[model samples]
Target: MALVIEGEERISAPVDKVWAALNDPAVLKEAIPGCQKLEMKSPTEMAATVVLKIGPIKATFQGEVTLKNLNPPNGYTIEGEGKGGIAGFAKGGADVTLAADGDNATILKYAAKADVGGKIAQLGSRLIESTSKKLAGQFFSTFGEKVGG
Candidate 1:
């Protein structure tokens, strides 16, 4: 399956603060809902395990995530690939942009694209779209709360 999703999140923090939050592995571990483990493998790389449940299916995905195309306090892109055992695999990337609203506010915009193969693709587009949106919302909501505090 080939899927695309776009979303924006307004954060109650400065661009620099938000950028710091984005780069910090600890912050990401806290913000990513359903994430079981997140380990920093290098400055720009991480290994993670996430358990995702959509409707009647539940799977654990082990993946490597990389951050690149960095422009401090502005934008960056992240790419990841996950293996889900018999469920097949998934690969995706997201471009995240941050714009300062004032001294203590920022707008975060993200455009994401993903592809799933094998059994995962058989799940149908509607299910995939809904699950993606829910996951995105969960991530941003948790991120905003963490950043706001």
Candidate 2:
């Protein structure tokens, strides 16, 4: 199954600050729901371990996340593909953009696309899509709050 989600939020910080925070491993770890570990492999790559639950199914996913289309204080694309053993596998990417709102605030926008396959897909396509959207919402809201404050 495939799904897409889009959203935006305002952060009460300057564009540079917001951009730095978004690229920070610790910040990403905290912003990503159920993210247990995030190890920066290089400037644009990270290894992540995350545990997610969808209704009665629970899975731990291991993945490599890469940042692309870099433009300082502007935006970038983040993409990852994770394996969940027998449960399934997921691959997704998000394009995020940042714009300065005056000199003290920034507006963040993103559009994400996700796809899944295997047992999880067969049983929970709808659930997965809804859950993905919910998680993205939660992540961005928390990200904005954390950066803004």
Highest TM-score against the true fold, candidate: 2
**Across residues 1-149, which tens digit of lDDT does each residue of candidate 2 receive?**
99999999999999999999989999989999999999999999999999988777799999999999999889999999999888889899999999999989999999999998877787666788889999999999999888898
Q: Which ten residues in a row have the lowest lDDT in candidate 1?
A: 50-59
TM-score for each prediction? 0.96, 0.97
Model 2 quality (TM-score): 0.97
lDDT of 1 by residue, 47-130 (tens): 999888766767888999999998997999999998888777888999999998878899999999988876777888898888
Candidate 1: segments with Cα more than 4 A from true spot? none
Error in Å for residue 128 of model 2: 1.5
Model 2 stretches with alpha carbons more than 4 Å out:
none
Question: RMSD in Å for candidate 2, one decimal?
Answer: 0.9
For candidate 2, which ten residues in a row score worst on lDDT?
Answer: 117-126
Q: How many residue pairs clash per model?
A: 0, 0
- What's the true lDDT of residue 58 in model 1? 77
